[model samples]
Target: MPPETGLRIPQDNRFVLSNARVPTELVADPPPGATRDAEGALLLDLLVQNGRIAALFPAGMAPETACRVDLEGRHLWPAFIDMHTHLDCGHAIPRVRPDGTIHGGFSLTAEDWPRWTDEDLDLRMEFGIRCAHAHGVSALRSHVDSETLAYSQRHWRALDRLRAKWAGKVDLQGVTICAMEAWIGPEARALADLAADMGGILGGVTDTLDRGENGTYDALGQALDRLFALAGERELDVDLHVDQTEDLSAFTIPEIAKARLRSGFKGRVVLGHCVNLSLMPPEVIDRTLALAREADLAFVSMPTPMMYLMDRKPGRTPRWRGVTTANEIRAAGLPLAIGGDNCRDAWFAYGDHDMLDTLKQAIRVFQADEPLTGSLAMASRVPADLIGRPDLGRIGADLPANLVIFQARSLNVILARDQADRIVLKNGRQVTDPLPQHHELEAALGLLDTAS
Candidate 1:
């Protein structure tokens, strides 16, 4: 165990955490005379009362308290939010992709769909949620596969049960994902109703594979229009997988923006992936970004899965990083959030649903640490706002004392290592449960023999 694990915190709900380092950006209003570290993080004392932040005091200025734990400058962060994930399909690694390509992964997942009974889904989904909670994520939004009504209902029921079970620990939200073309029929209305019933978001994919052959941009536009109309009717926010392909011609982001504007849909719209945007011509990229700005769309980039699946050819080292134009997206003054897209499933063979790991990879992949503080927001405040939960991602007075305390005191130290020894606290209490073991799922997932 790590040295920090040996430090005991007060079990009572009220206490003082002295000399804690918090990111300046995450602190709503710093107390006067607050001192900052080299990376612009504020050093302060945080008071917790009844599981919420009571107040913040400049280091060494806090009032006397019955219980005080001195962190001595250890970093503290608000619990993270992973706004884009696929928990319904998580941890089916036994159905690994054969060729290590996007299509191969899709095929394998489709073939394995029959194995997703309620028992199998509950076990795998709960396992992913536990991993995330242990790693200090307080909220997450998952895109459930909704190819058919039957499959949609089955998984939604499983998610509902898990949502209730994990309440107060992890705030769970679901979104329905299918091809945009599937939303052009009456089933679209049905799905929208189901999403609203569950307090979920409407989602679909607008990729080249989903679009019909021979430059069917017109049909794609109509499909998006119908999707937005359905979402508007139900007052549901829309999240779409857009242009996740290497083909430069596969630019569906512009169409989505146009559809959003044409439909006059006032609800929030989120566009995920858009890797082809990086491959587009400068003018095309500029035009698409302009449209996205007008539509006020949010972007979520899942670099881990995209890097693993995109631009892969047998025996050829991948040349380009399979990520969207992250810098450009942020520069456009649009919301950009990082997501843990897939975890140990057919779409991705590795992940533990850890947002810290996700943010670390994103910083390296996107060079997002220029300011460091802003990059951290991509995994926290940005996603929290996108999910319509502004109160969940920042450390402030009156907010729940959900946090991750890292032994690393500087930004460089935190990013250089995984911080696996970091401490997680929910509702002002340290989470002592170990991460759920993989062997626990062996019998449920039929991976006993395949276990390594």
Candidate 2:
């Protein structure tokens, strides 16, 4: 199809095309009989101008612009959305004892990070982002350490710098996955204020210090209210790192439900790692589902880290589910999503940096049928919208050009061969990025190659 007369996709954006064997059902095309020419495989040539989507071509049409690139033998899909991750505090260089066995995030020390310069921080951040792109992750809500004295204020500042540096390249959710020790006392309020002012997040936690004065349901509830109020006052989003446990009686997440009901905060919120939701008996899961639905809460199941760490703990044979209840959550008409909690950090050990792997894992672990239903949506527009990502998921005219190209014929193949590399497209042009730089840690920890 020729460029329409008097129609232009602005001179600033780049034009991109992907031609491969994408599953028809997964990759929706304009109606087969839609009146248009220039039809090709999954035609919807993205025109990304000014770092945003400018236009889309239909029915095998080519862009009139000369600055166009074609990706051959690759499938295009919505980029993955990783809704949960710790950005600055975890990833570090491989260390070893005098005997010389390498260690990763588990051995990472706050001292090591301060030894890094601004350039070093940028490299680390860039490496993480590149890893995400290689595995088809477009947007991420990365949690940074803002309240920790070791990092002090540096991690949040690093995140801000990285956000500006990689703004147009990929959508970055600069959030504060705050420290557990900093949640109470006078420092907590100030830290919360800083996170809100810095365009970061006020990440709440429930299972950090045990059921103490500061860790009880009542204590956690008050802290959440105060922090949420601060976040509201600053007009910031709240992404809580709640219960990563199986002992239902040991915790009380209903307070989260109560907070939502009392404050009615439905905007820009994410409930990360509700692993305990699975153990909540049918009645509790049902009630929580009702509350999450009422609050318009988005549940993100970071299957990788959540499952890996929980499995390693004793008396904690994971039941219900390692992630949250997907079937019940979705059926409740709530905005449910998924994220790769950790890539190569000690918090997690087996993430491939690919949500495709997450999807495949979700099927067997959660009893989900393969070739996921509303699957891509879990890691695409759903999370993208939550973090204010501008149209990076859907393939439509005027959406962002952050896209992925795969070599597989269908979602089934993609799921079966999770790590198979395929062509990639970013901002309407082909690009290359890799997954987490600290994967050697997982290997050393022996977390990979498990049944998960």
Best by lDDT: 1
Per residue, candidate 2 scores C-alpha lDDT tens digits across 262-354 of 875545667777777777679888987887666667777877666666644345464434677877887788777777766544455344556
TM-score attained by model 2: 0.78
TM-score of candidate 1 on Cα atoms, chains taken together: 0.96
Candidate 1 C-alpha lDDT tens digits along 311-368 = 8887899988999999889888889999999898777888899999989999999988
| Backbone collisions counted per model | 0, 14
Error of 2 at 385 (Å): 1.2
Whole-model alpha-carbon lDDT for candidate 2: 0.60
Model 1 residue 235 CA deviation (Å) reads: 1.2
- What are the candidates' C-alpha RMSDs? 1.7, 7.2
Off by over 4 Å in 1: 1-4, 95-98, 208-216
Q: Report every candidate's CA lDDT.
A: 0.87, 0.60
